[model samples]
Target: MSAPRNTAGHALVHGWKWLDGFASFFGAVVGGFYKIPGTRPIKTLLHGTWPLGHPLHPMITDLTIGGYTATVAVDVLYLITREPGVGHAADVLIVASFLTSLLSIVSGLTDWNSTYSEERRTGMLHGLLMVVASLGFIASIWLRVAGAEQRDLAIAVGIVAWLVLIVSSYFGGEMVFGYGTEVNRQAWATPPTKWERLDLSESSLDDRKPVVVKAKSGYPVFVVKLDGTVYAMGNTCTHAGGPLNEGKWVGGDRCEIECPWHASRFCVKDAKVHGGPATFSEVRFEVRAAEGRIEVRAR
Candidate 1:
């Protein structure tokens, strides 16, 4: 991305550009972490659980931030009211937030790997901000665990860290709302309300190759013939709108197709995503043959 010209928005623009560089460097490092063996279980535990139909990262992040905010509030009350119990609770929460953040970082990174180029740039910046905030909290935790005198310093550091984390969360929000990360593939799609007939005859169904057919409402659907059964799904790839009809069959799987642009794989039978880059499943349609003609309907 080229640097924009100096204007009313120059400072904001340049600040993001600098952050883009930092994110690129930091993402390069996280990419290396993938090389460490025995990471599958961790990926499954963090990403497989879709709390509230959203990725685990943001939910975990909200919980972690909530814990941090509670710890900060507890620290303030402990100082003002001279409650030893409050101080102890704050320490426990600080550690708890740190623990939850580990899973949040992992899940976020897993999703980030599949983000679009523009969103990934912001994703990395959000990650870097969290990293800095983590360091502050980790430092504060060390001091809090050391005892009473260090507790004052811990509170000071923790308050600052909590504020930093809130800002980081804003960037994270931008990645989703502003950039459409992890959103449903067909959220904006306007598929036909009623079933539409496809020109292909039932007897002419071919295996492993995809054909694009327009639905009654004009949404392009990817129709693939596999053995005797026919599969139909939205032609657009869920990840970035790459045309699925133009994509290729995933090797070894006749019922699956891979997006040519990003290689996001979708199962033809039900349009379920077995692999991603694409966190969302492909938009599928009900396909059947009636009176020798093939028809597809939005599901």
Candidate 2:
């Protein structure tokens, strides 16, 4: 809930620091759940790291939010017109929204598991609000399903749920625009346009051992030799800017490296993400050896 450094210009956000303690504990639980054997595959899909190359939570959240919004509109119309058709439409929309909410929760948790500190706290708060709102919506649905007598009560409950959803959505936006959660760490990285020489010699690099070198553009590059060929990529992991050099090599035939922080994996050859929690590829640098020294350029 507290930091050693000064926290200014975040007055409203700082007030929510009390939630950080809970976030740390729950975040550890989420991290442990994913670390369990046979769960990584599910985690990968939830993160949308493979096919989408972006976080999936944001992709599906709109469906749930939109559905609920439409349901609220129909509910208001039912209140004014008392039309049976409008009421039926509202019922259908609430059901669809409830289902999609489950999806958004799963994907959001998958991404939140990789967050830390203030981002984790904000995400936890956001998730809590969403869950509460979803439960309220579920109750509203149950009331509507009970009988026609409870229709007005259902509409009231649904409207309250929508308001909670709106507040929760604000926290979700803060996690992105404010904290950059699940955002591509290397998005702004500019690879070296020309060859850049490193201070170390080729012989100095131990086979299969990763090293960090700065490109002409001052961006760090991760360099490693495998099977007598030197490969280079952005040293900053696309997941959360974890130092790739600090991470260990993983995967036998895949030429993958695991991020030290969140365990996200990336292919060394193409810099493509090979695991969850990291949806963007690292910036690959073309590498070569000349006069026993290593050189790299943007691919």
Candidate 3:
């Protein structure tokens, strides 16, 4: 179902559809950087794949947004009270906002690198708006630092930055609430609870190659054999619903399955996410060789 069209947010995202070309081009450039050798660890850390097991961008954004919001509020107080200390507090908040926004931009770029199509476009628009706001705030800080005479102009710039931040936040919401970006692909999956036979027989399967099979529940299962052991998990990737069966086995030591769409990796044995853009783990299942066929059930 589409989101409600009655709101101005819907209009804003839809009206900006012309920006898709630029978004795609810029996203590809960022995507290429992450694909470079020796960048996986840094990308994975920014993705918050291992320790946090969730996207780091959204978490850090809270601090960035809060700092800017506080700055706006304090600026308003300065206008009302005309207290020198109140104006100084606003300046400090702007500086803090600028610093946190830099972290937000880095983490946001890491997450945005994997997006495609409409999600990519919306994300790029959101990111660009944030960059502009950051720049505006930086200018505001410089003005404030220059002298007391420029304080009023600095507050005006800070207010403009806050407004842009609000608009960008709306697009960010559209990406999540509308496009389901960063959402668990199998969040609503129903794994078979009973022994469900697979369509393929034992002899037809190949080692380290993923095969997609459907259970009695109609949910897709990814089946693979490695080192004489059979493993089964959700066939749909938790990141973007990419077919896991189409991806290749990666990490000689880790034994991970890398999603073809975004390179998200999940451990073959436990289905834990070993790399991201994927924050959630694939749902694992119990499998067995029975009557010349492989059968699986929910664990």
Judging by lDDT against the true structure, name the best candidate: 2
Candidate 2 has a TM-score of 0.92
- Candidate number that wins on lDDT, 2 or 3: 2
Per-structure clash totals for the candidates: 0, 0, 0
Candidate 1 residue-wise lDDT, 142-176, digit = tens: 99878888888999999999999998888787777
lDDT, residue 124, candidate 3: 83
Q: Report the C-alpha lDDT of model 3 over 59-149, residue by residue, as the tens digit.
A: 8888889999999999999989999999988888888878878878887888877776556767888988988888889889999999999
Runs in model 2 lying further than 4 Å from the true structure: 1-9
Candidate 1 lowest-lDDT run of ten: 1-10
Point to the candidate with the largest TM-score: 2
Model 3 alpha-carbon drift over 4 Å, by segment = 1-18
Per residue, candidate 2 scores C-alpha lDDT tens digits across 1-299 of: 11213333144555687888777777777778977899988888899996888889998999999999999999999999999999999999999999998989989988887776666777788988898899999999999999999999999999999999999998888787777778788889887868888776899877789899876678898999888888999999888789988887788784899999888898898888989788888888888888999988877
lDDT of candidates 1 onward, in order: 0.76, 0.85, 0.84
TM-score of 3: 0.90
